[model samples]
Target: MQRRTWVPIATGIVALVFFALPSEEPLRGFLPDWVSLVLIYWTFALPARMMVGMAWSVGLVVDIVSFGLPGAYALSKAVLVYLARVLALRVRTYPLWQQTIVVLGLLGIEALILTLIDFIVSGDLSGLQRWTAVVVGALVWPVVYWILRRARHLARLGH
Candidate 1:
């Protein structure tokens, strides 16, 4: 992979580690979904390179780490990336709030898809708690974007 590719991959790995860390509180549930935010950002910014299969693979790793229903996140991430790609042009033109709204919507759909899969596989509804994490991720989107943009800017300067 090129040097530019490593940044997003490394970011994804760090996100996976953060999400995989054990936690006792209810808020800990949201960590796994952070990868969706990272993926969306990169998908929009680098659509030529960040393909759906890559998203699916990253999602699979998250699934393995979280020990959730297998393939749940993999499928969701694939869909998220697909939507991001389809909407990339329009999304890039929108203001930050509009972009965040779109991301929030995508995150919600991802959560719903994962919940449906978990329900079908486990026949249990306990995964609803994970929605809180999605909500938190949505609320934090602007800050996440700002940080990511700054990092990208710094990386450009370094190069």
Candidate 2:
């Protein structure tokens, strides 16, 4: 793979390791859905290369690490990446607020998918409690976008 492709893949591997580590609270409570944020940024910044399969693989890794229902996160992330790719042109032109709204909508769908999967596997609705994470994720989208934009700019400069 090219060096540019390796950057996100390496960061993704690190993120997977980070999420796999133990924590005081439940694994779900501590992790900030960093994988989703990274995928979103990469999808916008480099959609020509970051495919849905890549996002799905990262989601599967997350599912394994977090001990949640298998394929739950994978499906959600794949769908999110697909949507981001499809709407990238329109989304790229919008203001930050509009972009944030779009990200929030995507997060909401992801949360619902996870909830449904958890409910299907566990026969309970406890997954609904994790909605806070989605809200926090939505609120943090702008900051993540800014950081990723700057990082991409610097990486290009270094080239």
Candidate 3:
């Protein structure tokens, strides 16, 4: 059980590192939501082990690390994980490209959730430009999927 979880937790830490990295304003929107991508990957890869409470905990870490409103990201990430779990069996069999579309939709929903929270919490309405991260996340989903899959294989977690 411990070995089974090690790779996913390691990947989650890597995602959190990227999430916490500082970026200039112009490039901020372009940064892929690494945390969501990782969460989505593991949710698909290890559906039995990657549950909602774990996602909520990671989101709280993201919230603290990014200094965002508390629980904002927690709620969004929890929802993302739930949706991923619901679609996991179907999406897992999808070719990478088709899976990318699903990733885009999932991340888009997350973006909408965050947008709503931001507007309600700070009265800030985000522009469509914010959606760029969603697109980028989807575009890179195959890459993230490949890398994490490779890691899982190397870790002998089984397919």
- Steric collisions counted per model: 0, 0, 0
- Runs in model 2 with CA error above 4 Å? 1-3, 17-31, 157-159
Candidate 3, residue 95: how far the Cα is off, in Å: 1.0
Clashing pairs in 1: none
TM-score of each: 0.88, 0.84, 0.93
lDDT for each residue of candidate 2 in 1-159, tens digit (9 for 90 to 100): 224545666667766775566667554663457778778878877777778998898888888887877888899999999988987877888999898888878878888888778777877887544677777777888988887777676555232
Q: Each prediction's Cα RMSD?
A: 2.9, 3.2, 1.8
Candidate 1 local lDDT, residue 115: 77
Superposition error at 3 for model 1 (Å)? 5.1
Question: Among all windows of ten consecutive residues in candidate 3, which has the lowest summed lDDT?
Answer: 1-10
- Most TM-score-accurate candidate: 3
The sequence of per-residue lDDT tens digits that candidate 1 reaches over residues 49-152 is 77889889988888898887678888999999999999887788899989988988898899888778878887877865677777788888898888777766
lDDT of 3 by residue, 24-125 (tens): 989987888899999998889878878899899999999999888889999999999999999999998898889999999999999999999889988989
Candidate 2, poorest ten consecutive residues by summed lDDT? 1-10
